[model samples]
Target: MEYRRRTVLRAGTAGIAAAVAGCLGSNSTDDEGSIAGEELALATTTSTYDTGLLDEINAAFQERFGAQVAANAQGTGQAIESARNGNADVILVHARSQEDEFMRNGYGVNRRDLMFNDFVIVGPSDDPAGVSDTEQATAAFEAIADVQAMFVSRGDDSGTHTKEMVIWAEASSEPGGEWYQETGDGMGDTLMIADESNAYTLADRGTFLSMQDNLDLEILLQGPIEGGPELLANPYGIMAINPEIHPNVNYQLAMAYIGFVTSPEGQDVIGNYTSNGQQLFFPEALSDDPNFQQYVPDGWQPNSNGE
Candidate 1:
C-alpha cells in the first residue's frame, strides 16, 4: 500500500536546537521548561532506527503532540532492558518470546502486534554452499556447515541472532566454533562484516534492503513461508512499560505513542515504508485469514522446504 513518506529533518547539533526551539513555542524561556523536559523516551531496535523509520515517526509524533521523542536505538534485548530499568517509557522490539516474557514478568503492558519482515541468510554471490537453490533453511545451513563455509553471526542476543541460533540448531547439533564468527554488533555492521569477509550471515530483510547498495552479499535463504515447525516467523511488537513499575515514566505519553503506531494511520505508514522503492514491513493484522498470525505473526514466515 502506498502512503506519503514523512520528511525527515536533519537533527544534527544545529537542527536539534532549532527543533527544540520550535517545539517549545514562543512562550518558553531559556532557563525554564526546555523542550527536552517534554520529550518522551522510546527504546527501539536498531533495524527500525537504522532504516530511518523511527525518525519519520518521531517527527510526526512531535509535530502532532508538541512532545518530542528521545529514541534509544539498540538491539531488542537492550531495548527491553532499558524499558525494564525505567530508562525508557516504551519499547519496539522483534523477539516475540522475549516480549511475552517481559509482559508476563510485569515489566510491560499493552503488548500489541506492530509490523514485520522476514530474516534472510546472505552470502557471497558465487554461492559456495550452493544455498542459492535450496528451499529448506536447515538444508542450506547444513550445506554451509558441511563445506565449513565462513559464516558471520551478530552474536549479540538481538532478535536476528536468536533466529540464527534456532536455524543452526535445526541443521546441526552446534552452530558455533571456528567457522562461525560472532561480531556482537548491530545488523548493518554485521552485514558489512559478512560482505567484507565473503561469509554468510542472517539479517532482517528490512536492514538487508536498506544496505543492499553498499554490500556485496546476496540473499541465500529467505525465512520459510510454509512447512510446520521448521519455519522461522519473525514478528515485531510494541509494549508500554508498566506505569506501576516505573512511576517516573511518562505513561500517558507512551500510550499516546502506542495508539499512534497501532492506529490505522500509523499502520498505514508502517505498511508503506520502503527502501529502494520496495516496501519493508507487511501489515498482517488486517488480513482476513484466521491463521495469518500463526503463519506470519507480523508479516513473514520462513519458506521451509519450498513449501
Candidate 2:
C-alpha cells in the first residue's frame, strides 16, 4: 500500500524550537555525543493527541531529558506513513495489525506495548438506530445499517476506521447510503461531525471522554461496559523507525524515546493522566496485571520475545 504524503501536525512551539537549534547555536549536544536538547519527531494517532495525553507526555519527556519532541498527530495509518517516509524518528499508534506489517516490512524496530483503551459506538441520545441494545460492536453496526440511521465514518484510514470495517464485514454490510457519511478528519473532528449530524460513529474511549461534555452524542455501546466483544479493545504500541532502512533517521533519539515510554516512569505518567476526573489510558508494558492482560489480543507480544 503506497502512502500519500500528508502534513504532520507538530505538537507545539517547544518542538519547533528544537528543530532550529542548529541555527540558534544552542549548543544542545551533550558530552556523550547525544543530541540531548535536539529535536525528535514522533508520528502518532490523533486520538492520543486529541485527548491531550500526548502533549502531557511530550512536556514531561522534554523537561526530564532536555530533548524536544515534535509530535505529528494523525491517524494510525498516516502516522505509519510518516515513519515509513523518514519524516519521523519514532511512532506511537494503536493499529496492531498495521504495526505488525510495518515491522515485517523492516520499517520499524524495538516495537513494544504501551497502553490501552477501548472503542465505543456513540450516537444521539434519542437512539434513532436503537443500537444501545446490541451486545457487541458488530450487532450495533448491523442495527445502525438496518435502520438506515445516520452514521458518520472517520473514513481516513485510521485505526478506528479499520476496526469499523472489520465490524461491518462481520455484519455482512458495506455501509453505503445517504444516511452514512464520511469525514476525512481526526477523531475529535469526526465526533463533532457526528454530533452536529446526529449520526452514529465509532470512537476511542479516551477521545470521547475528553470531548463528551461538548458533544450531543452518548455512548451507545462500549466494549467493556456491556460485556461487548473483544474487537473493541484498542491496544497501543511504540516503535523506532529502522535506521537500516533509512539511514537519515535519527535512530539514536528514536531508541531513547522508545526506551522512555516503555520505562516505569513513562507508564506511570500514562496511567495517572486523567480528564474530567476520568482516567483515559491504562499502562500495560512489561506488566503481568491480569486486568490489563485481558485487553491484550491473543498472540500479542511486547516484542519479538513474546514477553
- Number of the predicted model whose TM-score against the real structure is largest: 2
Estimate the TM-score for candidate 2: 0.84
lDDT of 1 by residue, 1-307 (tens): 1111122222244433443343333334441232333667788887998887888778766655567787887888878887787788788888876787787689888777788788887899999989877887788888888888999999888888878878777876467678889998999899999999999988888888899999989887776432322355777888777777877776656666776676665677788888999877766544454343432233444688764
Candidate 2: which stretches are off by over 4 Å? 1-33, 288-307
Q: What does candidate 1 score on TM?
A: 0.79
lDDT of 1 at 179: 88
User: Which stretches of model 1 miss by more than 4 angstroms?
Assistant: 1-37, 224-230, 284-307
Point out the worst 10-residue segment of candidate 2 by lDDT.
Answer: 1-10
lDDT of 2 by residue, 182-249 (tens): 99899999999999998999999999999999998999898773466788998888888777787666
Return the lDDT, model 1, position 235.
78
